[model samples]
Target: MIRNKKEYKQYLKRDRLALEIYNDGIINKLKNLFFPNPIWTFQKRMRKLEYYTNCKNYGLYKLYIYYLKYRYRKISIKLNFSIPINVFGPGLSIVHYGTIVINFTSRVGANCRMHACVNIGASGGEVQGPQLGDNVYIAPGAKIYGNISIPNNTAIGANAVVNKSFSEENTIIAGIPAKVIGKVDIKKIIKYV
Candidate 1:
């Protein structure tokens, strides 16, 4: 998160790429997507900008965030991520960007990888959004919501609707109102990352 000057500078670099993607034509974006660079990708920059916005300390950060808000709106027309900045930790990896809507109230841990069409929203007023732990991998079209506490190293399968919490760490949760399906090797999933 932008705790100091160095991190803030990094955030700016990422934001600059994001702006380039937005202002530049579709061909450039497609080229970057095909020949992907970790620093130049949309997901990386978005997450980095989100990290900066979460830190409410510096005026410069706030001003940059304000500029990002405008670009974010433009970008959201093609790729939607309405998640609040403070909700997610660092190392948030988005596999693909299309119709992904994460509620602002949701809290996701570090190094979480999410695919396309994933929704993490509120179930009710009393219950807030889901709280996901570290090294969580959410597959495509997963709809996870409510006051669920997903433990570390958990994997939510594709098209799964996780309404209930799975407390077991290093487990795979799938199906509607999701339950523990099986165990997973957390180390294997995170080793390359």
Candidate 2:
């Protein structure tokens, strides 16, 4: 359903759905609120759905949701060239969509928001991948390759290419090979609408 308001509210009526959404929001917000970086509002929105869903165990939830996400992502990648996906909880949200190829070893923190045409994979068969922190925001058309660690609350600008690890907070990164454009405020982003 791509996570519209009506769908979220309807889904939240269930006990488990409601609980899960809250936890998701809490986890995502932690990085946004405390971490020294900016996060994506879309991710926060996904978390609210988790809270509304009332998910209990993260492990089981991750497995179930990830499987579904992987399926959806694969299909969307093949057809639409656009992934209007709503990824909740954990695990599967990291599922690659379109030409977005995520390496098997890539570890993503809670509440990351990714868009279509993103490629997060290994560099030169290194086998190692990115270790992304909570509430990271990657705009469309970004490519993050190699064994990199993107710290909490960082925002990668649209069409940016990231090849190295970055830990500084509130940075707005952009360009081919992604340079720090500036810093961003996660709270301000979360407060968005």
| Candidate topping TM-score | 1
Model 2 ranges off by over 4 Å: 1-99, 190-193
Q: What is the C-alpha RMSD of each candidate to the true structure, in Å?
A: 5.9, 11.7
TM-score of 2: 0.54
lDDT (10s digit) by residue, model 2, range 1-193: 2235554454333312212333357766684466512112223333453443344326666666665555544544443333233323232232223455456577765455666678777799698877787667777788988988888778888889899888798788889878888989854543321
Q: Candidate 2: what lDDT?
A: 0.57
* Top candidate (lDDT): 1
Provide TM-scores for the models: 0.74, 0.54
**How many clashes show up in model 1?**
0
Per-residue C-alpha lDDT of model 1 across residues 1-193, encoded as one tens digit per residue: 4565466555454444323444368877787668665323444546556666655537767888777766656666656655555565555666666777888778987667778889999887745788999888889999998887899898889999998887788899998868888999876755423
Residue 153 in model 1: shift from native, Å?
0.4
